[model samples]
Target: MTTLHNAEAGDRDRKAFDDPAARGQLIRWFVSAAAISVPQAAGPVTFSLLALVLTGDTSGGAALILAMTVAQVLGAIPITRLGRNRSATWFLQGLIAIRTIALLLMAVLAAYGAPFLWLFLLTAVAGSVHGAAWGYLRSVLNGLTPASKMPRALGISATLNEVTFVLAPVAASGLGSLSPIFAVVAMAVLGAIPALLVPHVSVAPIEDTPHAGGSVLSPSILLWLMCSAAGGSAIAAIEIGAVALAIGFGYPPALAILFTVPLCLASVAGGIWVSVRNRAATRGMVVGLLCVMTGGAWLAAMQHSLALTIVGAVLIGAVLAPLATYYSLILDILAPPNKRPEVFALLRTANAIGIIFASAVLTATSLSVALLVVASTMLVVTLIVGAVSFKEKRRA
Candidate 1:
């Protein structure tokens, strides 16, 4: 009789774990988090254009972006630490509120002709809080998702995020056509939606234990971080120089939209594939994808034809979301359970650094040369990571 009761209890627990309502709430939270990323994904292009409009110079835009990236890197750790003991839902709501208010203030300032310096300061403020928002969102998802379902949940989240990346800039550009200030205001309104939805989400309590996993500086984590950085730099290089590439190919600058739309569509498809597979990527697969991505970058940079450019874009985009999904999965394996939020923040910091690196190179060289540099960097880093993984496997 006791054995039967034990079996029944186990079945009950398993059913609870697989509850459809719980999964539905998780999906809702994921959608809300992705919605928040829309404005963030649009930020670089919007701020850059705003800077150009206000100062009649591109350097102003670069400075604004630099300020934001620097602040985000510096603030990620402390902000995450502050929220470490709080309810995940409450913490996320607070961060979203801060971000919404900052963007609204930015819109007001832009509408009223605020000074460039003020705009830069506000951008930095918004960005500092923004890093923690992403960290907490990931943490919330971690707490809500079962280990067995993590890869699928993260894959779906990544796909939605790719959708945001695809639409945000296009939306910003469309709104900016009428008024850049209008774009800022619209993003501000969109930013508040997540805050309203956070209260309905539930998270499992994560036990704060010391015996979680290896440090973020461990070889596995470092290798994944480097791969993430390289991928980010490659993507940033393409995004930041798309307009210039369009002009270089004798097309109108507005045709830059053509480069991004196809790339994003392919990314969405790749993300869906990852979700459906619901499996973690192996080291061999990572290396192979990086090689493909590098080859695509080279093709895009070397070929001047519009047709080849679009093909190259598609090739790179096809691998990007899958690569990101793999990295998140690897990070889950490498990071301590208790350290997930901060570790995720560190990944964002690494990506931000890569963006800064690409931006600096673009400022110093032609778009083609900068792209070659991006591709070369990715190739070198990927080869090093592959070697490290091979060595580790051999030792194992």
Candidate 2:
């Protein structure tokens, strides 16, 4: 590989700029990674509904998601343990194989018109295994974009998630209704295709250097991890609620798939707007998050206003696409390198927790009420962060 720059100005941030060729290379790789995630973000809808279809209305869709999350939380450390020594490629390839097999089984089960829950459980397992690919690919991307442009890169990347819903669900459910097996097979194929494009970079193997920092059980780390889990749970809550919103508003239950497709696309659109506008500073992001959560919650709370709900969904989604990525980058800027993955892992864990919390809230109250709480919490968090950021800025 060609050395782009070595000066502190260049190296302080770890990405390339000024080279169209490098940018092109980055685009292809990033797009390839993002492409695979399409199945990930969209797969749950199909899996959930598939469960409903194959098993009964009492499908394990929610349970499957919870199970997958449980697996994800448990899997993170071990994957990192293994990842720290192994090539990221090994994980990537393994996920593809695992998903391919699981999906194939799901297709077969559907073909046979097997028990709904059984096939869904199969799909859930496949989806869960594939989650590792996100962190691994993101690590690789950490080396791809310039420090200054990192936010934009991440923004665009998050935004592309919008594409996940575009065709997958419509195709899956629309066609899957007619032929479930074919839908499973197509998804399996799409999910596996990207592994081929990852370049063979000779990074130090996992065994070459031991993982940095403490064990996954370390105390300070655990606290941070819990917080991240909180956020993740919130995300899940919002996601489930969003689907509910789509259905409750008089659309066909199947329309959740259609609604999600555009939501994902819109997230990407929001990301692109941020990327081009260059407006994702710490304060801006916190503010944006607050705006989305609060606005969306208020809209949902109103319940009777379709216009308000749509506006809220759009506003809430606008911030989610790039929110996590930017937050991670900011943390990276603030923390030492050895602590990065642990931090990222913890944040992801927190997000899971947030989803759980959100789910609980939804169960206790209307989606609108739960959203009101979510929005308020988000707004408060953002305002506090913004205040701190301003203080820190002034101090500096």
Candidate 3:
């Protein structure tokens, strides 16, 4: 009986995707995902170069990035809430337009020798919309694809995002060589593609029912969010500290790619694996992925040998997509239907917070120490998850 029901559901999912309109929207969403990801993937380098051009210091660039991240974390929920009564696609496009205008304004002002402070403020303006924009985009996905096919859809999106990260940096560097302001302009232009490309979908109105006001931050929701944060911090540590890791391994700064490239390649492979499998991970599998990531962080931190460290990086990369996809899928189930955008916004904010945590730790300590701290955090989170799961199983 269960097998028959499963087969019938699978057929329904496929038939939904078979519709020409649905397929078109999915394709558009894929392009939009890649488009938006380009700016984020290239942001650190582009902003750093912009700082160098304006103030002759890269630290200001990091500050700008921090300001943007902080603003996104602070603004995500409220901004998403404001759009509750509006069309998701329209709101998302508006947010993207706002960000694009801010980026363009910053570039124009930089050309006119604007104060670093003005540039900083503009960066914040652009970043404040990121989380809400992402939430709406995810919400749009919910409309374009059926629930049973969501894993595959998210998997494809993840794969594109990984590819964007792989290429965006190189593109930024190439464009930055001409002019950092030009690179910023290009980033803004590409980032705004989603504004134009995102297809319109009918948004169901949230009826004024009591359950519509349910809290989005239940303990179960927090558990998955904490998992996301831990994973983000662990990954950020490696990416942000890649140069340090290379130097400590007796390689030149230019060879930082030795660590970063392998990690990215592994991540792309992982994304592909998730797309091919197209299934949600079980609780035990989620816990196991967490353990693998924790072990990877520890191994990379050990810095005992170059080969070993690269191996560790690969391990961390290997589980990234599976875990990320699981978080999205599970959170969709846990969040209140009416408050989904807020929950998804918080999901993104959580990861941003994790990046901020990793950045702070790296600034205050050595790369080795930072990685250790990240690893330790992941370990603690993993144990907590394990304990909670054990209790749940016992109750069952």
Candidate 4:
């Protein structure tokens, strides 16, 4: 039965993509989504360089990112709800515009030898709109494509995003070496592409939907959100700590890509696999993926050898897309139709929170300790999700 449903869904997706108009809109959204992801993905490198220029230490960059992420978490739902009556394209554009302005101003102020505090505030301003922008961006897809096409659409988007994740940091590093301010300006300009490229999608006010009053964050929903955060933390621990991991492995900081590049390539492969498979994962599959990720985290944490660490990174990366797709698809099913923007906003926010958590741990602790903490967290989350799945099945 499941195979038949997936086959039908694949057929529908193919027919929809066969339409040039649908294909163009989806292609544009893919580009826009990739653009929107750049600032955040390039942030650690960009902000780290900027901080080094302003202050002698690089710690300020982490502080700025934390401020931005926290503000995003606080503003996500409220900012998304504000757009309930507006077109997703319009609202998303405005949000991107606001962030672009904030980033540009931060760059300008930094060039003038402005106070670091001023730069921090501007970073927060830019970040404040990020979660909502992502929410509306995700929401806009629903209008352009059918549910049957989502797995492919999301898989392709994930692949693009991983590519961005892989390349953005390199771009930021190269640009920042020339000038950190230039990198910031580049980030702002690239991020604004979404505002121009996103297709106009009309959205009905939340009040009009039949499921307008349904809860957005029930237990089932929280379970997936928790998994999303756990995955984010594990990934962040590796990416953000890549330099340190390299140093521990007796390599120069520039060799950090040895760890990061493999992870990203594996992630791209995972995304492609999801696209080709073109189906939602079953409960058992999800649980299996969760366990794979947990094992990956533990492997990286063990740090017995370089080969093992790289293997761990690969394991985690290989499962990232499938699990993330599951979270997004499940959340779409569980959330109120009218409140999807808010739920999706929370989804991005949860991932950001996980990144922040990893950042915080890295700040006060050694890389070894932080990896241990990340490993433990993923293990606990996997266990909890497995337990929940078991209970739900028994009830069914």
Candidate 5:
């Protein structure tokens, strides 16, 4: 571990490329990055589009999302366990190959109007594979990138995901008419490249045998995470409410789209911060982000006037970077380096599950009530976790 990489150290890190180890690691990272990019970019967007094409039903589209979330959670545990004991990277690559095959089938299904359930199930499987790949990439980053530069690496990874979101829509929506599966195939091809790069990452020679501890899930860590997640639920509720409030205020629902504009800008900017500045990844930032995210949501709710909500929306935009960065960093810090693939997948699952709960609330209750319920519950859990973590630290 070292201090922040200042100008000279960063220059050295840059020049470290001449060193064989650094050179090899960078090559591996970029190569895997290419493979991960297409799938990351196209999978969800295309899947939804494909589902709609197959059945012309929005519920089918919704099912694909729910399935992906559920499957990822279910898939992560076994994947992590396997990563710890096996050549998980190569194994993950194999999964990507399977995923590519699935996407192709989905293409066929979409073209011919196959059974809806089959199409949705395949979509879920693809999601599981994507989740597994994500976890693996994060773990690899933790191992290869020096502690001081990990934030930069994390920033690059998060930004890549953002790129995926932007491109998926364009490729699947616009160019999809020409070749629906082209986006998927491109994603699959790129997804597999990272697996090829995995063998290149030199596993540092630590002669010490690993401890096969009791339960891999630490009670304290789980407690903190669950608590954090609970409070964060409010952020989700508020988001839904914000959209409805805007619509009610007679500002077209599209006005809410402006919210993501700043959020996206802030996210990219935040990535640069983590990359260039030596910011210690801390739970404190996570708590702060959640609080701000919730506060923004609440503010938007209170601000029935479109103008006030817009300011709240900007605040919401600001919160995403810290929120995303914190969860990512926490996963990096807590999960063992090699076991990241599964954990990352699991993390996505948690997020998706959270979304599902939020969705349920939206469906069962009015949007405003849903937002209040999610936000209030989340705030309480966040405070409880903060208190517990403080006590634990003091005791330690």
Candidate 6:
């Protein structure tokens, strides 16, 4: 009787150790995150190519991105609110469906040679849900992973996202050579894979509760949002201006992938490093990384050589994952339990606003000028964050 009891106890322990649901949830979330990034990864290169093909100018590309960013900013809060009471899996499914339909419409219009204005309208419609979808994903992640394991999960997700960024452009450029419309349609289809996996993944519903200090206006949250905005602006400047930079350096437009691929690879490396190490970042570390990014942008802007551009890309990319991890960590630590999704939406809103600003500048001025603006924005934000960190330390 004692031997039989021991065997049963060991079996139960093994079962508990390898819970299928937990493992499945992690895999599904990673796939969903990668699927969501497909369009974003393709957008910069594909949209630029589309604009150049249709309007014979790059400004049209910038304008399209600007419209999308504006829509995302305007729609983030409301869309996120709608998901508050619903199942995250279902909400994400619906949003992804909407986005997929919008992309299909754009593809149809592009294939039929529709006017640029119509395409712009469709792009805005697609982007309207982008922030909400992102927020929902973040909330789902919180539900699926324990707080202690969140940093590693987020790091893995970030790495997968960077991998998408590395691969999508190559796919876009290659397919775009045949037809830009085909590339758009392809990305849309790929983006829907995550939605299909939603049914298999379980996400616990978040309960709403009132908290005295949960307001989004808290200084720490605000600071993080500002950092997100600055980071977004710098990244947008690099991505949107990549084609122009490549051409200016006497490289063919098709070779613009050279500008982004290495950057994304470096980001993947950073993310993997963070995941393996399993350490949290301090405000001081975040500020230091921001400084490195700022210096890189400045270096890239000051030099026109390919080598300088690659070096700058490495500098910026090395910090991307760490900065993202730190931002998510801060949000996790500071945001109220009931308000995580809304706060995440606000972060997305800030990023979209920054992208809009960068796109507008790119449209009005030169790529070099836009890069300098990015560098300046980073520097200013870094100083502010550093000051805040110092004050908090002194108080402690």
How big is the positional error of residue 87 in model 1, measured in Å on the Cα after superposition?
2.1
The CA lDDT of each predicted structure is 0.77, 0.60, 0.88, 0.89, 0.60, 0.80
Model 5 alpha-carbon miss at residue 28, Å: 5.4
User: Which residue pairs in model 4 clash with each other?
Assistant: none
Q: For candidate 2, which ten residues in a row score worst on lDDT?
A: 201-210
Q: List all candidate RMSDs to the true structure.
A: 3.6, 5.3, 2.8, 3.2, 4.5, 5.3
| Best candidate according to lDDT | 4
Stretches of candidate 2 exceeding 4 Å from the true structure? 1-21, 109-124, 202-239, 242-266, 278-280, 288-292, 334-342, 345-349, 387-395
Error of 1 at 390 (Å): 1.1
Best by TM-score: 3
lDDT of 4 by residue, 176-214 (tens): 999999999999999999999998865532221134346
Show the colliding residue pairs in model 6.
none
Error of 4 at 343 (Å): 0.5
In order of appearance, the predictions have TM-scores of: 0.88, 0.77, 0.95, 0.93, 0.80, 0.86
lDDT of 2 by residue, 282-373 (tens): 65555556556556655655666666666655666666655655565654544334444445554555665576678778889987678777
Query: In angstroms, how far off is 344's CA in candidate 5?
Result: 3.6
Locate the minimum summed-lDDT window of 10 residues in model 1: 203-212
Q: Write the per-residue lDDT of candidate 1 for residues 1-396, one digit (tens) a residue.
A: 979966775665456458887766676777787887766777766776776777777677567668878888899889988988877668878887887788788878877888777888887887887677777777777556655566677778878888888788878888876777778778777776778765344444232213347676787788878888888887788777889988888889998877878888888898888889877778788888988888878777776688887787888888887788788767766677667777778887888878888888998998889989988898798789778878978999
Estimate the lDDT of model 4. 0.89
Stretches of candidate 1 exceeding 4 Å from the true structure: 1-18, 48-62, 199-214
List residue ranges in candidate 6 displaced over 4 A. 1-18, 48-62, 112-116, 199-212, 243-258, 304-309
In order of lDDT, best first, we have: 4, 3, 6, 1, 5, 2
- Candidate 1 has an lDDT of 0.77
**Sequence-dependent TM-score of model 5:** 0.80
